[model samples]
Target: MKNKGVVFTTQAAMIAAIYVVLTVVFAPFSFGSVQVRIAEALTILPAFTPAAIPGLFVGCLIGNILGGAMLPDIIFGTLATLIGAVFTYILRNQNKFLAPLPPIVANTVIIPYVLRFAYGEAIPIPLLMLSIGIGEVISCGVLGMILYFTLNKYKHRLFAL
Candidate 1:
C-alpha cells in the first residue's frame, strides 16, 4: 500500500515535470491564441492512470506561470487541464479513440476566452475559438491520440503499480 502511494506520487511528479519541459521547450508555440502546446500530448495519460488528473493540473499551472501568462490564463488554463484530465480518466474504460476528446474540447472551449480577456487579444472570440480549437485538435487530438496508441502498447509495464 505504501509503495502504491509512492508510485502514484512519483508518476504524477514525472508527468508534471515532462509537461513543464515540453511546454518550455516549445514555448514559441506553447502560448498565445495561435498555439499548439505540444505538451498537451501528455493529456492522454489520464486514460491510463488517475494520477494524470492532478499531474496535468499542476503542470499547466506551472507551465502558465513559466510562460508569463496573465492571472486569468494561469487560473483558467489550469482549470481547463484539470477538467480535461478528469474527464479523460472517467472515460478511460470506453473506446480508446475517445480518450483525447475531453482535453480537445475543454481547451477549445476555454482557451478562446482566456486569449480574449487575459491576453487582451484583438481577435474576435469566434476567430480566437477557431484558432484555439485548431491548436487543441492538433495537440490533444492528433498528438494525444498518437501518444495514446504508443503508450497502450506498454501500459502494464509503464503504468503498473
Candidate 2:
C-alpha cells in the first residue's frame, strides 16, 4: 500500500515535470492568441490514471507562470487544464477515441476568452474561438490521440495505478 502511494506520487511528479518541459521547450507555440501548446498533448494522461489530473493542473500552472502568461491566463488557464483533466479521467472508460474530447472542449471553450481578456488580444470572439479550437484540435485532438494510441499499448506497465 505504501509503495503504491509512492508510485502514484512519483508518476504525478514525473507527469508534471514532463508537461512543464514540453511547454517550455515549445515556448514559442505554447502561448499567445494563436498557439498550439504541444504540452497539451499530455492532457490525455488522465485517461491512464487520476494522478494525471493534478499533474496536468500543476504543470499548466507552472507552464503559464514560466511562459509569462497574464494573470487571468495563469489562473483560468490552469483551471481549463484541471477541468479537462477531470473530465478526461471521468470518461477514461469510454471509447478510447473520446478520451481527448474533454480537454479539447474545455480548452476550446475557455482559451478564447483567456486570449481576448487576459492578453487583451483584439481578435473577434468567434474568430478567437475558432483559432483556439483549431489549436486544441491539433494538440489535444490530433496529437493527443496519437499519444493515446502509443501509450495504450504500454499503459498497463507504464501507468499501472
Candidate 3:
C-alpha cells in the first residue's frame, strides 16, 4: 500500500512537471495576443487521474508567471484554466473525448477579450475570435483527441486511475 501510494505521488508529480515543461516549451505559441497553446492538449489527462487538478492548475500558474502575464491576465487567465480543468475533472470518467474541449472553449472565449481590452489591442472581437479559436481548435480539437486515444489505449495498465 505504501509503495502504491509513493508510485501514485511520483506519477502525479511527473505529470505536473511534464505539463509545466510542455507549457514552457510552447510558451511562445501558448501566450501573447494569439496563441495555440499546444500544451493545453495535455489537459485531457484528467480523464486518467484526479491529480490532474493540481497538476494543471500549478502548470497554468507557473506558465502564466514565466509567460509574463500581468495581474489581471494571471488572475483571470488562471481562473479560466482552473475552471475548465474542474469541468474536465468532473466529467473525466464519463467521456474522455470531451475532457479537453472545455479548456479550449473557455480559453478561446476569454483570451480574445483579454487580448483586446487587457492588452490594448485594437483587434475586433470576431477576428480575434477567429484567430484564437482556430488556434485552440487545432490544439485541443486535433491534438487533444490524439492524446485521448493514446492514453485511452493504455489507460488500464499505464494510467493507474
Candidate 4:
C-alpha cells in the first residue's frame, strides 16, 4: 500500500468508528448482565491488521462512556476490550475461528465483576458468567465467524500488508 502509515491510520480509525456506531446503535443489547454486543463481531479484525488492537480498545472506551457506564465499567470494561484485542492480534496466526476467543473469554470473566461492583447487580457471579459467556458466544463466536469470512475475502484490499 502506498503511504502505508496513512493507510494504517485510516483503516484503524474506520474500524474504531464502525465499532462505536454499532455498539451505540444497539446500546440496549450492547451492555449489562447479558450483553450481546454486535460490534464485538469486529474483534476478528485484528487477524487482518494490528491496527484493530487499538481500534477495538478506543471504540470500546467510547462505547462504554456513551452507554452511561459507571467508573469501574468504563475503566475495567475498556481494559477487557484492550486485553482481548491484544490477544486476538497475537493469535492471528492460528485458525480464523479461534481469533474471537480472547475477547469472548476476557469479557466473560471480567464483565461479571464489573456488573456486581459497578451496578450492584444481585445476580450470582456464576450465573452472570454463564449468561455473559453465552451472549459472547453469540456475538464474538457466531457473528465473529461470519465477519471473519466476509472480511477475509477483501482483507488484502482492506488492510495494510
Best by lDDT: 1
Where model 1 places Cα greater than 4 Å from the true spot, the runs are: none
TM-score of 2: 0.97
Of the two candidates 2 and 3, the one with more favorable lDDT, higher being better, is 2
Q: Give the TM-score of candidate 4.
A: 0.97
Per-prediction TM-score? 0.97, 0.97, 0.87, 0.97
Span of 10 residues, lowest total lDDT, candidate 2: 1-10
Residue 154 miss distance in model 4 (angstroms): 1.3
Residue pairs with colliding backbones in model 4 are none
Order of quality (lDDT): 1, 2, 4, 3
Q: Model 3 over residues 66-141: C-alpha lDDT tens digits?
A: 7788777777777777777788888886756778778877887887888877787787988888888888778777
The RMSD of every model to the true structure, in order and in angstroms, is: 1.1, 1.1, 2.1, 1.0
Q: Write one digit per residue (lDDT tens) for candidate 1, span 132-161.
A: 889998999999999999998999999987
lDDT to native, each model: 0.91, 0.90, 0.78, 0.90
10 residues in a row with least lDDT, candidate 4? 1-10
- The residue pairs that clash in candidate 2, if any, are none
Model 1 is weakest, by summed lDDT over 10 consecutive residues, at 1-10
lDDT of 4 by residue, 1-161 (tens): 38877777877788889999999999999998978999998888888899888888888999889889999999999998888889999999988778999999999999999999989999999999999999989998999999999888888777845
What clash count goes with each model?
0, 0, 0, 0
